[model samples]
Structure formats: structure tokens, C-alpha cells
Target: EEAGEHVLEVEVSLPELAELLGEELRLPAIRPRGREAVLSDVRRYRSIRRTGPESLRHFRRTFRTALRRQIAEGTYEPDRPVVVPRREDRRYRSWRIAEVPQSNAAVIYMMDVSGSMGTEQKEIVRIEAFWIDTWLRSQYRNIEVRYIVHDAAAREVDRHSFFHLRESGGTKISSAYELCSRIVEERYSPMEWNVYPFHFSDGDNWSGGDTRTCMELLREKLLPRVNVFCYGQVKSAYGSGQFKVDLDDELGDDGRVLTSEIPDREGILPSIRTFLGTGR
Candidate 1:
């Protein structure tokens, strides 16, 4: 039983794992439309043997012949003698090298960490971000991700801090946008990077003037450089819920601006698909 189990484990391959993931995720067979094709076929490359026949099938035959020769020579002492294989007894497996294009994407995830963004809203953002990252990774080999969390002010942080940090300061959405624009200008150039900036909030801002400033930043600085700028308004009881409407009224004609309402965790997946499905 142990030997059988060991054999079964050794026989399991990468293709089998890929098939399992495919079935579990129910990922659509859709590939990125224009440049690089999705990975449809998954398999393992076989290694070449250094000794005997070049092919495994041929090597097996040669191995059998060598054993038979030893038996005929009458030098096959079961206890002390051994059989030596010649150079023709080796075999090997073959595979092709697959070259894939590098996708230049920079995802800036900005979120409001004010008192209004409660545990439930944060959970939704976490779930949605995971799916977005997974889908983007599948599509691009070179995906750069940046996380910014804000309350009264905006600051760049690592992934852990972005999702976990909490504050009780007032909301100023424009501050976050300004920080994002600066990051793009200093670190990520529009010509070299395909930018995707996503902001999540409870749709509340400090003032209308700040919101107007946010719009100006998006219009003159962010919108032209990015492939898509997505805004997700997470519903909160404490929130006034006015930012999304303002964005729609101002930037509805811009193809690059995408806005969605994430009422709860259940809406996270669809919202993510809405933001990324365009392959922009």
C-alpha cells in the first residue's frame, strides 16, 4: 500500500494541478483580446537522459536487451554481479519554450480609512482587491501595485497597512487623489506603464471645494495617463453617499472613468470585473 501511494504521488503532474484550479475557480476561458494570448494549455516538460537511447520508449527496449545479454553471458550472479547499460540505453522527454509578452500595469488602490469605513466595508474591499489582483496577475507578468490609505490626509503605505489601518479623522477625498497623482508623476510614467487607479470610499467628502479639486486632478493629471480610473462607493450608514453621483455628473462622458456602487461584500466580485474586464 505504501509503495502504491508513493508511485501515485510521483505520477501527479502540473497539468493535473492546472485542471483542478480551472474547475474550482470556474475562470472563463476568455483571453486578453489583442496582444498576448492566455495560457490555455498546461503541461510539464520532460527531461532528457544522459546515457543510452534518446527516447524513453527506445531506452526501455535497450534496457531489456542489456538485461537479456547479461543473462546469456552467465555472469548474472544475483548476489554480487550487476548489469551495465551502454550509451544507447538512455532516454529523454521534450518540450517547447513558450514566450509571453510582459503586461505593463500599475494598480493604485486608494481607500478611505475613516471612522465611517467599518469592518464590513473593509472586508468587502479586501475580497474585491484579492480577486482584482488575481485576475490582473493572470493577464500580466509585470503588474505593479501601490496602496494608499487616507482619512483627513493621504499617505502611501504597504499592502498590510492599507487594508488594516483605521482612523477617526475627517474625509478629504482630494488629498488621496493628489497623492496618487504625485506617485504617478514621480514613480510611474504614463508612457511606460498602463495605469489603473481604483478608489474606495463611503462617498463622503469634507467639502464641495475639495471634491472639485479631486475632479480637476482626475481631468488634467490622472485621466489622460491612466487606462482606467475606477471609483467604488462602499455603502455605510454613517456616510452621506454623495461622491459617486458627483463623479457621474462630472465625468460620465470620459471612457476611462468607471464608477460602481459596492453595497456589500456580495457586490465585490462584479465590481472588480467591471473595472478590469475591459483589459485596459
Candidate 2:
């Protein structure tokens, strides 16, 4: 039994990752909720005119024009009626640009960066986010991502900063929701884009008042404006982890808002399924 030892090596490519994520989560292929305007250059033989490249020359029209010209000009001798096509007799096809309406989507990711949310939680978020991105990217023609991080306050950050930054402060979960709502309002129009918002945290908050505020924002501004809003509560030894309970108790199976509890890396994929399987 090789000294009762075992090892496993795992390697995943982009396509494989997407497939695995979809399979594990049982995610439905998303149909983007809103319409996008697309410009397309369409080539058609809609019109024919007597001036084009040789490749586009209309043979029948050119021969007819040549014959008509010879007959009308009195150059058609009955014994030998000769007709030659001139450059002016050639015809060609043309094309035009048309505007098409397509569908698009955007993903907004937010996270709690208080001391309670440590390296392990962030790692889970990163891995789950990767798979989520893979699936959503495949679903929409054009997709965009925005990141926000919060400790006592929320700030916009790049993808790198969202995953790596650390802050030792009290948790203000509502701040993140406020900023996320503003971003959605300003940049992603619900009528024109399929908006998805995901937030991960250790379920800690400064106060129950703030949690109520977050709930209001979701029910009013966010739930009405996004295709789906997902929340993931990561377990932490230092956190009270009460925010998840509050959301579940308040929202109570609302389709627009989904919640998942991820205890660690092992729970990442399952949480993904719980959050996205509804196909919202």
C-alpha cells in the first residue's frame, strides 16, 4: 500500500473550471435580463449600380446595356450586330451598417475585511469568485466586474486589492451595501444590464441597527434593481456571525436575495451551488 500513503494532484484549465463549476453547482445558463445595443456591418446584394469592382460586375445587366446601346446608336449592323460591354455598364452590390440589440451582464463583488475575516475566508472568497466568474462570463456576451471592501467603512478597490487588503477595525456591513447600491445606480442600469451582486463576510457587524439598514437597502434599492443579490457568510472564530441569521429571518426565502454559509474552503463549492443553483 506504499507505506499507507497517498497523494493527489489537481490541475484545471479555464474551460474545465467552467464546466466543473456548472456541474457542481447545477447552475442554469443565465439569460441576461436586459438588452444591449450592438452595431453590425451587414453586407447584402440589396442594390445594383453600374459602377463597382470587376468581381462584383453583373454579367446579365452589363450585356443588356451593351446591346441596348449598340441598337439605339445605329451601330448594330444586321449582318454583324456586335456588342461590347464598357466599364459604365458594370454593376455591383453594396452593404450597410445595422444596429442590433443584444444582452449583457455585470457582477459586483463585495467583502468584509474586518480582522475577523482572515486569510482562510479570503481564500475561500477568491476561489469561489473565480468559478462564479467563469460561469457568468460564459452566460453573457459582455460582462463587467466591480470590487468593494469594507471594515468600518467601504471603499472601491481593484481586484487585487479586494482579495489582499487587510484592516483591523469594527465591522460595518451596511457601508459595503451602501457603496454597492450607489455603484449599481450610477454605472449599471437595471433596465439595460443584468446586474448581479455578491457579498462575503464573517457575519459580524457593529450593531443590529446597521444590519437593519443593510436589509432596507436590499429590499428597496438593490432587490428591485438587480437580477440577483447573493450573500455568503464565512465562519470565523472571532466573529459573532449574527448577520446571516438576521438576513434569513427578515428576507425569508425571497427569490431575489440568496444566502449561503461557507464554513471554510471545503464549503466553497457547495455555497456556490446554494447561491446560484436557482438560476436567477
Residue-by-residue lDDT tens digits, candidate 2, 83-183: 67777766665444433225677899999998888898899999999988988765555789999999999999999999999999999989999999999
Candidate 1, which segments miss by more than 4 Å at Cα? 1-99
Note the Cα lDDT for every prediction shown.
Answer: 0.76, 0.81
Name model 2 segments beyond 4 Å from true.
1-13, 37-102
For each candidate, what TM-score against the reference? 0.68, 0.72
Tell me the lDDT of model 1 at 169. Answer: 93
Best by lDDT: 2
lDDT of 1 by residue, 83-170 (tens): 6666554444445454333546788999999999998899899888876776666555578999999999999999999889999999
> Candidate 2 has what TM-score?
0.72
Model 1 scores worst on lDDT over the 10 consecutive residues at 1-10
Q: What pairs collide in candidate 2?
A: none
Residue range with the least summed lDDT across 10 consecutive positions in model 2: 1-10
